[model samples]
Target: MTKIVPKILEDPFGNLTIENVLEDIVLGSSPYQVTNPHPYKPISMPRGCGFHGNQTKILIMMYSGPGNINQRRHVRQTWRELKDPNVRLVFLLGLLEDAQYVLEDESDQYGDIVQEDFCESHGNKSTKMVMGYNWAVTHCPAADVILILDETLHVVSDIVFEYIRDLVTESPTRLFRNDIRPDQHTGNSYVNLISFDVAKQFHILFPYIKPKDENLNDYVRTVANILSIKHIYDPYLDHENPASFFAFTGQNVSKHLLTYPLNINFRRLVGRKVLYNEDIPHQPINENLPPNIHRPTRCKLLRKGAVQDQFLVVVWSDAFDSEQRSTIREAWGYPNITVKIVFVVGFLDNHQNKIDAESTTYGDILQVSAKTNKFHDTLKTVATFTWIAQNCENTKFVLFLDGNINVNTSMTMTLMKELVKSNDRKVFLGQVNNELEPDRNAKSLTYVSENDYPFDRVPPRMLGLNYILSFDLIKTFDISFPFVKYCSAVDIYIGIVASKLMLTLRNDERFDRTSHSSFLRGIP
Candidate 1:
């Protein structure tokens, strides 16, 4: 490795720049090599568009990292609709050797990716932005304004375009403006809008070096100071209500409950489909949306794991199931058992007081703040798995069971003990179903839309009723679940997650599927 001496390299403008240093490191490195841009007309714009790179008026660039295909797909489905002969959409990614093939596949399908050759790291994010700016400067030179947005944000392009268009028309030479709109002046890197001229100048002064300890906005502000770029606080971008906001983060965006006109003729399109308003409903399904548990206490939230416990048995429950909870506590939830037992619940309307009281009295309820409905069972499991990861630090194994089922805890413990003898970490043991067809009947409650899952057969997954995962397997689920799109069926979702994580789904016949008659007949 060649040593980098800052004092030896100085530019003619008297401002020290890392342009040469970066060029040498990127171009001369073994793993870093600039691949040819995919051969297609309007190389800068996404595929299937007539717009040329230079003629585009507005370009929207979203920054993302490798393996974030789902986030990019969300952008394509929602915001990419704004792409026309003039407007263009593209995603910026850092180069990863392991993900090169995946990136190539996405590029072939979307044709709107800009992958920079660099060592992908959080601190190197500014380098990625600088690379994007340089690309825009070269390819989309005529682009009037560039909206540098984060992948986590949901943007309404029409509102954003109109706002920027009016602003440019009103004041052509202005440099930077806060996207939060009308009155809010505070700027954040989450979303930043800059005119093309300003971007060109900004790139020259600070041509994208790896940022040390500062964030992108701070670095941008430093550049703004160097060039004396005027940053005006404008309210057109920032609206207090996320539904009306021109652009907002995914956290602020609620699950938009769309009301489509009832029509069996979805297979047939008559001319163009009319678009409907996508406003936040006055009454959302459940108040427990996301970022579950605003203020979690030790009672409701599990902190550190018990030092002596080797396994945790979590019963997935809802607030209304007081009777079942009571029976389960008396039968299986024994304090003397070596394995830890707890009930996990998502917030339910009209049952908070009862649930809180039950929790206080029994101290076995693990109340999660995330919204849970019949259709969002996948989300509930996600929250529960995440909680276990955060709180059960010393646990070796975890078993997830439904509240309606009665399990042989002694037998389950024996099974877990035998599995531990093998010294295998990728164990996902339960009653497995390998050949389940996707329900196509639209009227059926179990029906899955083709848009959500087009596959003909479900991957092998364990029945969710009584499944055990080694701590290593649970940790893997926590790491990989966010990257993939999930189905409404919690079992199928778990299957998909396990398949992606390359976990072994072993079927143990002892995990029998007993009917409700077997477990619930004489609970009282």
Candidate 2:
């Protein structure tokens, strides 16, 4: 069972408290400083700053509407609590047409207040508010950080200020406001922060913001892509209660820092069993058999009386030491099975040594260029099989096996027998689990079903660790799928194509159910 652990941190804004009447009216909690001193102190600059020279200015743009006394009070109260030397708070009011009379008296009540006259129009207040802030930001060149706050938000000024400060300092680039809900197309409590350089780059890349009729989400997504900004969505901060703190900095930091929830209880329950220590013991082989044994005939053979020529085994070698290769060779070094190993080597300079070692072990090697191996494509590697199969016509059966897999001699024989026994002429074989247990924990073997299968399934699955294909099938595949220039994992590409072509896929219970190593049991 997977268990989730909660991370605990000191509440950054635990000190702010409001009267019951005020609390009942407000939707979100206010921000308060946890421990840090005021960030900046006042000067001729727009906002006061506590720390000179090094101080960062925070500009909060509060939007208000006429007759929104509660929202205005909330904004004023929030600003009062945020009265630090480094922060500046500005309130902007959007008045409906013919309601300009209401703002005349309130302008004197609030200092540093700006009003926009909207007459004979039913404009969206939210859009106007955003435009006002954009204007202020453009005009106020000195402002370093900007926080666009909705009037209804009750926040602890100190906590939010510090959280923003920490984010600006820690993030490789500025953080953007991102919506928490996946379904929401727009309007979530997320912000994007970019460095000055990135901001300039964005301006150059995307010159204009879309009009009101256009989708804002599309515009933002374009900007985000241009800037390569990472989005953080915090569900906890989108709430309207005291637990809202859990929604803010607390939730943000927790989600970002802890990719996986710590399973403390499960860790204690599993204990030292987490670290597995079993090593696979090497098995010796019997070299008494004929030098070139014919294909086994115990099972239903695809081509009746098909004379034995050469065994064609496909080796999916990643990397292996000489000893490991020798051990595998001895176990599988039968006269009937001629091994043709395919090496999928990536170009990353760091992995060059591993590639070199495998090349030394396997004589038949396919070198895939790393420049084209981007985005998990292995089709290019698999395409090389066409040339191998065409060149080696005497090869009867093609065996695909991962280089690192430990296959016993008996297991190989059993797999080969099953493949030969399969009745379908265009058959692809793999192992399947018997039980309905999670794929991660299932141990039993089962036969793969030949139901409605699609051919064009990329990286064909169920075909198990190794797939056996007859020479005829290979010839047909090469001819039918001429454009096999794959840039993805071969298994997936093969599966997808097989499914599209309605290929007959068979699962061998004996090979699928067998566990060669104990290490697989603990695989997460």
Candidate 3:
């Protein structure tokens, strides 16, 4: 029979010098038992059976801290749940030098319940090794497995222990619910259960860890190294339970099981209700019909000579800061174009400043405030389209642009030519980019499908940045003006209006110049 030699080192104050005790255990000629005893447990595993009915001894390690009533209650419950008759549960508590005076009295209460260990130093290293040594000497002779437990962590039910027992029986591996990675932003944290083999291996690689060290996420990494243990992270285990075990374990394993739904308790507790209201019917703005007006064949908007010289460009400038207005002015610096820029200033307090008309050579600036009260910003955008119809007569087309947009002069010209070539008189022109591949269509136009309007797509075109619109469509919008009020967002409102009006929107890939790189690369 191999003789078991126990070597103990106790330091309650040191971060974690438990590796020293592990070194002693592995180096010793004989088998060893390890234990830690303190009033408060850090974090640990449940006590249970090993592979092939082998007897496993458990050491409950603790550092001194205020006793938690909840944890104690759970611990008592866990004790009742353990079914294995062969497992021995040993508790080791570390005592300070001052506590030694009354140690005899303290020992009397717990000595019968758990094996008591004492260390002189307050550092964690001394405390950990001393307890480990005590367990080795007292239990190593017959122990085939070792269980470590922290005081704060409690077994919710006996099922937890049985689950771990089954895990060990099936594999000679470490089990944990923690994952740590260099790419991850959050550092080491506890996970439910991990195996000793991996823990021991981790200890070899990271024998001594400082809490403040950037690489030192959790203390368990060191132990996992020393044990040479293969590990499996079970998401269903509840050693850490509601709180994540990965938090302390620093194991970056993907959770396979969906044991619990996220944020259920809070959602149930809040009891918030969502109410649905009936949508009001939209009415046309322009009642008058053109005698010569005819709906184009194939529902296409663009036909030659459809777009005219005089047009209204509705630029949605929710908050026209000086920088944005300046960019708009610089981009639209054409002199010969008969286009007037209509600025829709949403959420307006006062028109304190206006876009400089003299600087904008291509068009004149028209500000239409939504005056939507608390919801003023949204209303102003709606008002912009309406205002364009009521005010801009003889305007053949309407072009919408966002204030921050910078137009590629050549691309804009090319887009205008396409709009002219596809002069259907009822269709809207929009820009398309190759980068937005998901939205692209075979027609080289991007459109979203609508169930109700099988013939007409919802949000007809990918409407953003700059687009040219027919003046007749603007007139049609004038009739629909009163029915629609302030919408939540401007773009969606335009989409809804375009959808209902049956406006044929066309895509002009040439004008697709909006990009993040353009902004990031600087305004060259």
Candidate 4:
């Protein structure tokens, strides 16, 4: 190896940075981690995103600061987009007591924090690879891939998940940002998904070269070259698209990308459609109305004098369950002057004539598609939301319930109106479930494979099939379905989408998930 003298790297955050650990620097020598001891170092690490000793397919270590509590919270919320059990997420943090004095509580609650005493700075950023290497070796040795993600990342798009899964088979040297050019394989602190083998090699080279934050990617390239890892540039993933690359809010942008600033807000879109501005009027399901509507387009408000206070109840039901519909109408869905209840069902195959007759009789039925496949209820859910987005404008709230859920319609509607009035913003109601492990039983109908939905636990969501949502969120769900992975479990799928948008999930004492009838008779 070529020999050279060590240069003094400056940090914007502090003077010391990681300088204390480099007193005995091995300049231009054999690559190894610089672990010289320093004062005030308190490290708290975890053993990968492992469960019962399962080998991890991807190990994600995000670089965060002790002060970046909001960033951490939001990033963690976005992390649920990676819905695979084999994929593990860890927050790599440095010491800073002011913004975060109590990481123990946070770490214990989530069990995904890896803390070290060094203060986070640009100069010290090179140490991230070193720390990640050490942690993976000690805690997640079997992990096949390691992605050094930046804290700025806001949304992990479907392309990202799809690209990472391809990595398991491809095993490329690096997966850099889509914006990266052939001349520049290196990107500034933008997320780079690297093979574990490449990470292990880079960890050793990191301390020896000790490049600055901007030059770090070049060294990463060097390590890939040394390992002979295949390098390929992907064009599908990007920085501007909220469906893929998104950064945190505020003016912080990359000079290259507006000085590394990120944009997190998703454009208002619904599934397989985005023409909400078109004011096409939709007539009621009368005798002249068509029998089936296959993903209809832009529509006016369901009610003529529609205001923000009006709410709609969408019931998911089987196409043939006319009896079930009658029962619901008799029990809780009685014709009311205020609340409008609509039934979203699959197409009636041979019984099309039967549905036509039923449709003419009751103008509340909405056929989304041909018979929805088993475990693909999320499809119908998105369809329902899309119809609402196109049809229900200026609506205040929506009560999404399964046909089987026995809810007191009057009480639920009154409660939802009051809740929306009190909050005065987009909100999610019903049983709020934050962390739930996916079912691993292969034989079970709701079985979740590691590759299918990679998250260790489902993201924060309104649990029971029955719940209430702001109409805006209903539209968001419609637009967001295509961006996320296909989930067979409807509630879990909805929760995953909610997490991506970081919706305000609220639990009501009355919205009990355990029993058949929720909200008035139970829990409260």
Candidate 5:
């Protein structure tokens, strides 16, 4: 953590002293900002061995929070490419309260943690990234290229300066970047790379833009446009999409390689090829993945907003259903400024390019790497909630919907706020199908034999096409996914799981099964 000292700081964290900032004159700086008014003096910075070196290096700068020590440790341990002197990695961090004690130990052990003085927040990402560039220019001037990475990424490449230099040399002279962001976040900060000269020019020449949803990436975009910094988009060389990703891993794993979690695909692309099939061509599905203490999370959705209170919405989608999703965006009044919509879909082999492109453009789709099928939809839905329960426990409510279901989110929002106010738990709000019978026909996918569920009727539950589950029930519901067998119908299977968990199914008349839009259950 940086020393606590008085300085002209924009974020209101606490009294802190950053690095020796020379001036505070630049304001209303970059093109991203309509009017930048923050001062230019750092209050505090991580005290340690600076980004010092004279040799050429590919500096991979990771945006990290103070409490993300485990993530940093993972980066330190798994990134085997750092063996080369031409490659360096550092975690750019911001300050936190009780988290600083553990961070101090981490900083002491590893000289790579660069903690800036500003308070860590989702809103201050632009300032954080600026801090990274500032450190790169002022301290690590020897970096040949800077890879803007995230703390949660598992990098799979042996990126050397020689390979990067070759990439830079072969590209058009105007191109100064190698953006690998599959999801165009802040324009794609997770897996983006900029040349040393561009980083320096941006640091020295550009003005600091005010913080916004599209902060650092917008700033970089502004700089790129101003400098005519065009990057050659090569799938294998510069940025490989899902095809190369599947090629590299092939059938060696089954944990599901999501375009979201594995955002930075800086893998070793030695003998990569475009994969056409969903599964491996000749290889068998590898089932020997190490057992997990908890259920493995497959959802790669980053719903970054006021998720501290509740999960606003999660839409069930198909990988190839971009057109439907696009319509949903407009129909549901998407690009929701408060809480972004998340599209949940299983992977598709041929449609991956489209999915990736759509993801890059909207950055709203959450790809759960599970295969798609009638029997597997339950798994997909459950896995997404499981992932959410583990990663986002603070979430109060979750609205799960089919892609075609156009919801009146404002109405739902009002109902959800009431639910939150009442602190309702074990809530399953939908058109409960209480007397469903399993398909006794042997030929049907959902055919259930007498021994499977000797019961006369299916348990009470809502149809899978749409439903609303409170946050309290998600973890319990997720527990049934691994053990409960997949049913012929997804909703019925969920009902069975609910019955097993003894969760009361609540029927809301608003959930009209006959209508395409069911969430608006009670309205005339």
Candidate 6:
């Protein structure tokens, strides 16, 4: 093993001249090769380079953590068996002191390990992939395409091979060409494949010392734009919901695609679509907005002091009428020093341009990434909680108001202030309902299966129509969001969470369901 140097200025183990390091950086040389003893040595290789004679040979490399010994073993047992002349599996890891012994043992046994000298951290993952690319270019020069993937993925290489085969057959010109005009086909770097020529093109653009907080996908897109290589995005392989535990289940996968490690029983639980349902095509809902309109994210939307020095009021809104939003704004969105209003909305395809224009004008709409309008209601709860936790961390209390509801913002703030001063316990104030039964009807749209909600009796929860979440409660909810099973009913889900946490729900009559007569009709 060779000692890896972090910078050209200093070497930890051995002395290397700054001039030499500069030369390496200029010549597109890999610093990884310095410490690697067997740079091109493989624990396992295809007999006679398997498909070495083929014009478009491929090598699949996975970026793995030094500590994930078990994951490497799992890969060896599953997809590693699929390795052939055209396809090869290599685990790229950094030399960590804690796991060096295990990595060495595993390498000796499996012979598929590609260890580098760089220390691996969450921030340096991009560096590892870059080194992997450099290694592929230098050592595995025969390979035409390199598929970079995370070690956790369970892949079907046959499907990938078939897709690549067809792709190459269709666009043979893309194989040996470098002067093609670049296109804007950005893709997730987590699981993607790039041709050897394309990968080299990106390596040239990537600085030896990466920029601070640089995202891998952004870097890939930048390079992709320069190369004009159209992306071959396989939704079944790349589109994973990192937040959902059941996202990788078999049912979500297509028959003609490669999906992941889901069990038989869990996959059977997913609902199936009828193939020959009667054609009842409904007209697309038009937002009555202009055409070809797209909204670019503005810096002012994320500018500081937007939510500063005030109690953040996050109002949940679906594709409710614009009139409803205006009503709430006119009624409670007054010029107040203590309260700041921000609308949390899900993506509505028909109304996004309208929403974007509204956001640009007001700079108060906090748009979230929800796939469709149908996810508008359920996803808002999660997205709202997340935004508050991240952006409004220093703020006092957060008020979650519905789009259609009428609220006395002044009274709500007064009650919140009183509650905060009076009690030190986490404050969760709303119209508390106790022991509501879970919606168990299978045919119903709002059905709750035993898998989703196992409890017979629902926990006490505050109705989401109007509620105040204190700072502590927001923090807890943020941490719990990843673990909690999501349901469409926001109130019930929060109630179940409250029950789990054993937190007391404070009921306030002032947060009424019906608008008061004094403020009704028009609050003039």
Clashes of each: 11, 62, 92, 25, 14, 5
- TM-scores of the candidates are 0.41, 0.35, 0.32, 0.45, 0.39, 0.39
Residue pairs with clashing backbones, model 6: 2-35, 43-111, 50-85, 182-228, 183-228
What's the true lDDT of residue 391 in model 5? 63
Task: Give per-residue CA lDDT, model 3, range 1-524, as digits (tens).
Answer: 12121122333433324455456546762122223223433222222223234444333333232223344444545564665655544444454445444544543443312323334243354345334433434434344334454454444323334434545565545454343322344553322244454434333333233223333334454344434333333333222212222112232223211121121221112112111222223343322221211111111223333443454455655444645655665566634333455455433344343443322432344444334343344355445555555556555666666666555544555555555565546656665211211232335333322221222111323445566677666655544444433233344445545433333345544445545322212233
Number of clashes in model 1?
A: 11
Candidate 4 Cα outliers beyond 4 Å, as residue runs: 1-309, 332-337, 371-375, 513-524
Give the candidate order by descending TM-score.
4, 1, 5, 6, 2, 3
Name the candidate that leads on lDDT.
1
Worst 10 residues of 3 by lDDT: 290-299
- Give me the displacement of residue 70 in model 6, in angstroms: 47
Error of 1 at 486 (Å): 2.8
Each model's lDDT comes to: 0.60, 0.42, 0.40, 0.59, 0.56, 0.55
Off by over 4 Å in 2: 1-54, 118-126, 182-207, 212-218, 234-237, 240-524
Q: Please report the TM-score between candidate 2 and the true structure.
A: 0.35
Kindly list the per-residue Cα lDDT of model 4 for residues 316-348, writing each as its tens digit: 877788888887776653665345668887776
The local distance difference test score of model 6 is 0.55
Looking at candidate 5, what is the lDDT of residue 167?
52
Could you give candidate 6's per-residue lDDT for residues 121-145 as a string of tens digits?
8777677767676666666767667
- lDDT per residue for candidate 1 within 1-524, as digits (tens), equals 23332332334345333444445444653122222222222222343323555442677888888788888888888775665556778888877778878888898887888875675666666767777876787777777888777787776424456445655665566458754333323445566778888887765545333233446666676666545565754333333322222444544333211011111111111101212323222232222326653222222223444322666778877678998888776676454544567787778879888987887777677776654554467777777777777777566778777787666555666766776566665567777664446678989866777676655555566755677788766766665455445567777767665543334466666665554322222123
RMSD of 2: 24.5
Candidate 4 local distance difference test against the native: 0.59
How do the residues 373-488 of candidate 2 rate in per-residue lDDT, one tens digit apiece?
23223433344455554566655666666556755555565555555565434555555211211122124232121121111111224544566677655655543333322323
